[model samples]
Target: MLTIWGRRTSSNVQALMWCVGELALEFQRHDVGHRFGGLNTDGFRKLNPNGTIPVIQDGERPPLWETGPILRYLASAYGEDDFWPRDPTRQAEVDKWAEWAKINVAMAFTVPVFWRVVRTPEAEHDHHAIEKALTALESTLAIADAQLSEHAFLCGSCLTLADIQLGHVLYRYYDIDISRTSLPNLRRYYDTLTERPAYQTHVMISYDELRRN
Candidate 1:
């Protein structure tokens, strides 16, 4: 059994959960982060020095921190061929987009936009910073839109680690009250992801708890 530490609403945790769900791996999830304050405890600190959410303890192996590596680890260890390829070349292809998604899309929105718009109170919102972040994110998403235009998934026809890395962020991107450029391909991909039970269970969740009144 695996032990994962993080709040369900945390995007980083959600990514790992989505991957775990896709693999149908049974595991225990400990609530932490935000109002759940176990992250500051000595035990949790031993697991992750940075005190980030979504740390995974796999039996005797050392606990794993960081969403990207955790996803790759779970996929490689437990994912079927469709989710994670054994071939190095094929895996590299999936790795590229996973890196892009984490750095470009996830990082762009969570701190600059989501935290500002959703976490911050309405009176204290930084509209200017949000708009700037949105503008920058738009350009990054456009590249994905073009790539999705050519195939059903990021790397190819079937869902892979690449899609898992990027797909979790789509829910907030669409649901948030923000202006977005027309992205038919990205929209189509998101629709396809919605049809997946794992994605719905792990990724398509409300962040109402995270919002300020």
Candidate 2:
């Protein structure tokens, strides 16, 4: 059986768990980050020296860290043709969007927008910085909106690994109490993603536990 180590609330961990759900792979998940804390243990360090959550151990193979690579490995090893695709060009297209989502959209939104607004105390919150970050995020999301306008999913009409990586951030983007530009295509894509049982189960987790109230 495959084993995953991470808290359920982590976005990265959720991405992996969502991929596992989509692949219908049997796996056991253990809470090990955030408030869970078992990362510094010697046993845990043997699996991942960096002590990052979301390390996956498959059978006797070495544990894998990093959400993107872990997801790619799962899709390649266990997923059907449609999930990861076989054609080099098609796979490249999928990879492009996954990187964009992680580097552009996810990174843009999390720290500058989400952490500042949700995790920071109201008195300490930097509203100006938040606005600036949101402006940048809105610009970044525009590219996704443009792509989604032409295709049902990030890579195509069917859901792919790109969607799994990208879609996880939408719940936080929309659910967070932040002002956002009207992104009709992105919203439609997110709404469509939410219909999937895997996405709902993994990506749509509440962040109320992470909030600073």
- Against the true structure, whose lDDT is highest? 1
lDDT values for all models: 0.91, 0.90
The estimated TM-scores of all candidates read 0.97, 0.97
Which prediction has the highest TM-score against the true structure?
Answer: 2
Residues 15-52, candidate 1: write the lDDT tens digits: 88988888899899999999889888999999999989
The Cα error of candidate 2 at residue 52, in Å, is 0.8
For 1-213, candidate 2 gives per-residue lDDT tens digits of 899999999989989999999989999899998888999999999999999988999999999999889989998999777778888898888888898888998889888899999888888989899999999999989999999999999988788999887899899889987888999999999899889999999888888888886
- What residue runs in model 1 are displaced by over 4 Å at the alpha carbon? none
Stretches of candidate 2 exceeding 4 Å from the true structure: none
Report lDDT (Cα) of residue 201, candidate 1: 95
